[model samples]
Target: MVGAIILWIIMIAFLFFILHAVIQSALDSSNMAKNIQDIRDYLYDTKREGRTDKRAVAEQLLSTQPGAPQDLYEECPACGEKIIQHEPECPSCGLRLKD
Candidate 1:
């Protein structure tokens, strides 16, 4: 009788562990899907704006650093717009400025 009760308790604990694993897996998949959708949206917007280079898109996604100081701003060669020296592309003309 005592052995039977112990077996049932062990089984319940095992089931709870399985349930927790399933919930965590589901949440991870949902987060990954949302991230992919966000990247797609960003690519679509950039393409619609005439920025078609895939390398440029990748670089933009990888770069998260803030722009240089305002006093360090320089003229964009392609569009003549004032841009920070550290910018990878010209904001006004979509021209690639950095190597």
Candidate 2:
């Protein structure tokens, strides 16, 4: 009788462990799906806004700090698009930067 009780207890413990693992996996999958949907929505909105340039979108979304210098970016001479100060070439116009 004691052996039978021990076997039942072991089986119940194993089942509980498996049940918790499956529940955790389900929650993780749900969170991943939500994250992917959010990303899809964001990309769709960006495309709807007619913005194909990722750099321009990032620059526009990033607000400069109050005490930041103003010369951190410059316009590309060929296309008048904004370029980071240290970039060696303009991504939009393909113009070679001298400085």
Leading candidate by lDDT: 1
TM-score of every candidate: 0.33, 0.33
Candidate 1 residue-wise lDDT at 45: 92
Superposed Cα deviation of residue 78, candidate 2 (Å)? 52
Collision count of model 1: 0
Give the lowest summed-lDDT range of ten residues in model 2. Answer: 59-68
Error of 1 at 97 (Å): 23
lDDT of 2 by residue, 3-99 (tens): 9999999999999999999998887689666665666776688899988986665454333233446666889889999888767898887898975
For model 1, what is the C-alpha lDDT against the true structure? 0.77
- In model 1, the runs with Cα more than 4 Å from the true position are 1-29, 64-99
Cα deviation of 39, candidate 1, in Å:
0.6
